[model samples]
Target chain A: MVLAFKNETFRDDFTFSNSPAAIRRFPFPFVEDKYMYSVNIEPHELGPKGSVYEFPIDIDEHYVSEMRDRALVLDADPGRCQALPHMITAQWDMLELLMTSMARDYPEHFSLTRDGNQWHWINRPLGIDHKFTFGDVATLPYQPMEYIGRQCQGDFSIQDQRDGQLWMDAGIITTQADWSLDFDVGMNFFEWHAPVPLAHQAGVFDRALKFLLNMQHGRPVRRLNWTMTINSRLDTSPENYHKWGIDRTTVTPENVGDKVHLRVELQALWRLPRSNAILFSIRCYMIKMRELATVPKWGRRLPRVLRTLPDEIADYKGLTRYRQTTIDWLSKYDDGAPTSLGGGPD
Target chain B: MSTIKSRPIYPGLSPDPNARRNVVVCDAAGAEAVVELLARADGEFAGRTSVVLSSEGLFGKESESIVERLKPATVETTAGLVPAIDRLKEILASATMGLRLYAAGSEPLIGSVVQAGAENFIDPLSVRTEHRGSLKRRVQCVHCKGMTENVTTNPVKCAQCGLLLLVRDHYSKRLAAFQGVCINAETPDESPELKVEFQ
Candidate 1:
């Protein structure tokens, strides 16, 4: 059957539409001309609300399209989503957490009917009504987390909290912004983020780790991170570097405006009530430079940040090749708009 | 997109600047000239908030009817005579500050315009709309996933497939339309109900 609304067409048509939903919900990251990375984490409620992933688990307009993309990614690379054999409890915890969250947020479309050990979960959006007993893997067709993740829009991973640190152990991640789930699995929280520049030297990671460790069960924390991509491709992981990596260098100056995309990942970390595992959800969004330029301030600020950005950070971000050209294109709309252009003493 | 950037810019903390709040409204009849209206405000328009009003176009008119009426001047006023969506997009991309967008029109018109801003990541707080026109909707057929604009009936005919569809409250933001499910989905031989006024 033909899908009702294919995402590619929707994006192509809406990207240029003034005030299209895609441009409005886009999280423009640069606030000033000078650029630097720090522990930018914040409480989930404090950040701009209702733009993305409002609840612990959010189902948005892109839910169906993203889910379809995930399925394709999984089919192409089984290594994209995996759960260690010993992490079954965490998987079950995530499954329950996701179900309850969905049922609470979209009650009309999702419901969880429970009677003691037996429970019935209905996903109206997916048209799936499942009945299973709690804690019984056999009752479900697939692993609890995997089964639930198949329908989720965000990539999820669980970290076991112990020994004064959280260990990255289990997850179902098909759409990673950059890092690899297979490579980072089993690495401690700090180690997983080790590749991220400046966070460690600046003590941002230590402070964030402490904050994450002390996170209360009911409270969830989230933060927004952003970068630029060469194209609209969502699967920007290194695993398929050959597929998209070449585009980075080959894109000419004329097409750079339309080809370059701003990628923002909204990452939320939750302290699962039981099993003491932290569920991290990452949802990615991309808007090209031409569309992003519509936001006058965004168009202006982005280039200044890039032009003044140090080479190290630029290299780290894979922006070294096109940073200048991207800056030139964004500068067309800049008109020397008022901005903070120089870096301050750290 | 993953990049490792290493630049020791200002090593220290800097105060985060507040984004300039902008207001843009789109409707069948765009609001009055923004500059003149702001000139009449208690104080001057000191560039704190940029305002642009994109109203629907008038057929056979050489100049935008609203722009001609307002004859607005200054950076704060734009008599956007083209499709509000096109003008709004142009306004949104050029600003250097954060924006707050407002739309006033029919449900379908407002929803479609708002969906554009939502897609661009405009903060929900920064965006609001007052429904000012008809109660009709823009429906999307679930069976064919095609959008039918300006629908007025509950059991509307799907423009794409000619199927009788019962419109549901479920609005898909992606399609920016209420789902119109096939009325005879379960019963293949039964004649579907013809028409009913939408709420």
Candidate 2:
């Protein structure tokens, strides 16, 4: 598919918005009228054409702008992209995964040509064509992971599997949801997720860890996780909480439709062939409440889901202040009507 | 939710009789724990043990008394926790097999000792730890990534960024500090009431 990439900004005078087509393929997270924590993982198999899951790596209209935002973030805070010394091999593994998937899935926008260890890659959208040795870091302009991660559309983390646990050894996370990659760099699965409430007692991590540990090469899995962002802002990191947290307070019934955004993460994990590490990709999709309400089924279902959300969850997702206002606004579209079963617009 | 999964749990110290060399790292308030650990050991354990004591704030006299009572093979005393950890690192540098590391002190001291051990290729979970002193915490500001030591309040101010932060039990062994995030970020002017929860 040839995508007419949008020119937008995710910060300061936020001009980011979703087109009608973008909203249709937004990866709406709710499968029902209510929501709660669950393992919700599924095989990352190809979905219906034009859907987000149609390809392993989904690059949409936001690709160029998102990459630009990532570059701006890296220029300001280079620590956002870090890799431990031992994760060098895993870095190359991730580079290969992203390059191959992109070149194969979107042939027009990207291409990869290989001659033994020397490889050539062309990213037409970003206007880059480079040739370098695959295994050699000195041959590339940046480290393998950062080089490829800069071009990718989502936050990528590599988890080194050892001691029967997955350690978050390397990542390039600029558009995170209130988490700091610097603080969480060396943490294991359970340790990084320690701040989340209620999921631990439900044995969510325990089950999820077991499932990821045995992940085989060429067989990846995916799940959807979500939170509400006050704007179309992407860099909602804890490092900038003092700057953007104030947006939550600014939400009112008057501006709830334009300001409130449902941020959904399409999290996928693939076991790397060489490093025995898992590549975790978090592709964020943001749609404002106004754009989401265009879909009849989603407009009816979202308010019901928010109204029944547990207090602990609402607080944890940082939606306590704006949730009621957004729900009240969305309730106008919910005519006490029955919606479809799955997370699809009808 | 009573205990955070990432928060390290100190399984109170127990002497390892089979170890050829024993190293004990402690703060002033942890002297009692060291004394009890040595007392419980069988067969001349103190003869092969070395102690690193940090008598930083209070309990100076108590630390001196414990040193006099438990006359281990060698005792190195420092004015603060930083120097004690440096001494511990030097000792670990020359360490061989059959070495058992024991840390008994405030969470910061113990966590630092464990972190130093980890840098020397020793597994942190293998280090014996006993919480003995003040419940004061060491917190890392999630914003500026600056660490503030000896935090005694819940909603403490970040020493670097000046943001009033809520100290969370979510901890990092690698960083050896609890995570601190802005408390009233949304409503910046409204600061929550401070509580001496850590103390």
Instruction: Report the number of the highest-lDDT candidate.
Output: 2
Off by over 4 Å in 2: B58-61
Angstrom error of the Cα, residue B46, model 1: value is 85
lDDT of each: 0.65, 0.92
Considering the two chains of model 1, state its CAPRI-style docking category.
incorrect
Model 2, A257-332: lDDT tens per residue?
Answer: 8899999999999999999999999999999999999999999999999999999999999999888889899999
Candidate 1 ranges beyond 4 A from true positions: A1-6, A9-19, A46-50, A339-346, B1-199
Native contacts retained, all candidates in order: 0.00, 0.73
* Lowest lDDT 10-residue stretch of candidate 2 chain A: A319-328
Q: List the residue pairs that clash in candidate 2.
A: none
| B45: Cα error in model 1, Å | 86
